[model samples]
Target: MRALVLDRPGSFRVAEVPDPVPEADQIVVQVECCGICGTDLHILAGEFPPTPYPITPGHEFAGIVAARGADVRPDLPVGARVAVDPSLYCGYCRRCRAGRDNLCENWAAIGDTVNGAFAEFVAVPAVNAYRLPDQFDGQLGAMVEPLACAVHGIRRLGLLGPVSAEPTVVIGAGTMGLLMLQLLLHAGAGPVAVVDRVRYRLEVARKLGAAQAVTDASALGDVRFAVAVDATGVPEAVETAIGLLDRGGRMLVFGVTPAEAAIRVSPFRVYNDEITITGSMAILRSFGEAVDLLSGGAVDPRPLLSEPLPLEGYGDAVDRIRAGQGIKWHIRPI
Candidate 1:
């Protein structure tokens, strides 16, 4: 099989690799589509180390079952469409037993820790694959993971109030920000505002549902929001969102910053205003909920997709992402 291997930091190469074989309780999937996530870029740049050298990079993917291990249930026969739940955890762990698998102490991401779906075929534990509706295309199904994450974050904000018309602000206009914007408007937010440093992304945000989009933070002068969210994946953006919240307002930290990054805020103001600053990690148990949203057409994320390339184009794909060229990129393994 031809796979994109991260040979080392600052490099990726298309090379021949042996096809994966499923364990007794696992299944082999013929990967159809894979989404390039921000974590993949960080891994390639030597920022965060999840695995040793020479690993395939992909996690957000969907495909058909090509083969199954001997112990796998025969009821789930070959050719079943499925989406991969890339987070593998020990069910006996304290966090997993407490229903917080996303926060498990010994968590291993599929693409980072293990060889993931960046090739024609990849093996995964049967317990980690969720069977999807037959009509669900792999391209659209690949979005379930990220959409599920957005669902977890948006629901955490408790956006619904008796009024259903509170002013909400979303900082950042990337794929995550746009999805959050759509979810906010769907939940009946009032005059949602989107902020970003890039002009094109802000425009996409407006088309998705933002009432206002601005590249300048000064444009938000004196604006108070009932709910605020930071999706820039930057500590500075989180701080900005904290300052934009109204008294008793709720702020959701939906972004992930570097491990070394830190933001300092006033403890005095936090105590005085009754402000709620919450942090959201990966989707807790929202994968199915996200698939339901996309399946039902309540939120349309199709427009957020801008680029599609084959596995061999992984390097160019990352370049485009680094250059701030588009919202999201998809890789077709077929």
Candidate 2:
């Protein structure tokens, strides 16, 4: 099998590697499509501490079961179409026991800590595979992972309705930002606004139900939001989003910002206004719900997807994402 193997932080190659064989509880999946995520960028830059060297970094993916281990479930047979949950949680971890597995102490993931789907084939635990409907093709199935993250973010955000609809601003119009916007709208968050420097992305956000899509947060004028979401993972953007919240507003940091980055906040404002600020990590127990939403047509990501690049185009995909040239870039390894 061929894969994009990163020998170190600043380098990678499309080279031949041994095909992954299933473990006793795992299955070998023929990867169809794997979306490049911000985490991937972090791993590529050595900024993500959990990642190890000489690894394949891609977790947002879906594929067909090509082979299965002997103990695999009957329902998850070979040749089945599936979208995998890359989360590797320790069942006995304290956090897992408390139903907060996303914060598990021994947390690891397929692409983050192990070899992942930036290849022709990857082995994943059978239990992590969710059968996709026949209607979900490669790209749509690949969308389940990111949507799952967004779903988990919303869950972390808690109850959103406040008697009536109010403005919910989503900062950044990238893939995650746009997905967050859709979820906020479906949660009955009224007249959601979107902010991004990319005009095309704002246009897409408008098409996806953003009441107002602006190129900059300042362009939004003095308008304030009952809820504000930062999805760019840029510290400056996060600060700007925090500033957009109205009195008693809730802020959800949905983006993966720098671990060491700090932002200025008015302690008096938080105390006086009763403001609540929270941060959402990756997928928790939300993978199934994301698949359900996509299958039911409740969340549409087709507009955010662009033509996928081949395995060899991995570097180009990274550059495109860093340059903000596209929304979601997928690597079709096969």
Candidate 3:
């Protein structure tokens, strides 16, 4: 099988590697599409500590089942199309036991900690692969992972239970931000405003149903929101999102910021106004809901996708992502 192998930070190649064979209770998937994420760039730069070198780097993906281990259930037979949840947790850890598996003490993921779907074939645990509906194509199936993350973020915002029309401000109109915007609208969150420096992304946000889309938060001056979400992974942007919150506002840090990154929030304001600030990690039990949302036509991420690249185009795709050329990029290894 041909895969984009990252031998170390700052270096990678499309190399020929032996095909993956499913271990016990695992299934081998013929990868159809794999989306590059910010975490992928971090892994490439040696910034994400959990990543190991000489590994295949891709997690957001979907594919057809090519083989299954002997113990796998009949429901997950070969040829089934599916989207995989890359999260790998030590089930016995305290965090996992507490139902916070995303924060597992021995946390790992498919692409982050093991060889992943940036190849013609990859082996994953059968339990992590959620079967997709017949209507789901490769690109849309690949989107389920990010949408799952957004779903978890929404759950963290406490908006899942009821139609809490909290005036919401989503910072950064990138793929994740746009997904957040759509979910906010779907959850009946009201008058959702989107902020991004890129006017192009703001346009996309508007088309996707943002009540207000601006290149900068200053454009919405004096308009405080009840919910503030930072999806840019930029500390400055996080602070800007914080500034847009109303009294008693809830702020969700949905972005992946650096470990050393820090933000300034008024402690006095948090105390006086009873502000709630929460951080969302990766996918939790949200993957199934995301799959349902996508398969059922409730969320459309197709607008965020451009033409996918072949396995060999992985480097160029990375450059495009770094250059901010597109909303999302995918790799079709098949």
Candidate rank order under lDDT: 3, 2, 1
Against the reference, the lDDT scores of all candidates come to: 0.84, 0.91, 0.93
In candidate 1, residue 18 scores what lDDT?
Answer: 90
C-alpha TM-score for every candidate: 0.95, 0.97, 0.99
Distance from true location, Cα of 222 in model 1, Å = 2.5
Better of 1 and 3 by TM-score: 3
Q: Clashes in model 1: which pairs? A: none
How much is the lDDT of residue 133 in candidate 2? 96
Candidate 1 on 167-275: residue-level lDDT in tens? Answer: 8999988878888888788778867999999998887887787888999667977879989899988899889888888888889998889888999887887889878
RMSD of 3: 0.8
Better of 1 and 3 by lDDT: 3
Q: Put down candidate 2 lDDT per residue, 1-334, tens digits, no spaces.
A: 9999999999999999888988899999999999999889889999889898999989999999999999998999889999999999998978999999999999999999999999999999999999999999999999999999998888877842333588889998999999998888878886999989899999999999999999888888888888898998889988898899899898998888777899999999899988899988898989999998899887899999989999999999999988989899999998
Residue range with the least summed lDDT across 10 consecutive positions in model 2: 155-164
Number of the candidate with higher lDDT, 2 or 3: 3
Kindly provide the TM-score of model 3 when superposed on the true structure, using C-alpha atoms: 0.99
Candidate 1 Cα RMSD after full superposition onto the native fold (Å): 1.8
Over the full model, what C-alpha lDDT does candidate 1 score relative to the true structure?
0.84
| Candidate 1 segments whose C-alpha is farther than 4 A from its true place | 159-163
Ten-residue stretch with the least lDDT total in model 1: 155-164
Enumerate residue pairs that collide in model 3: none
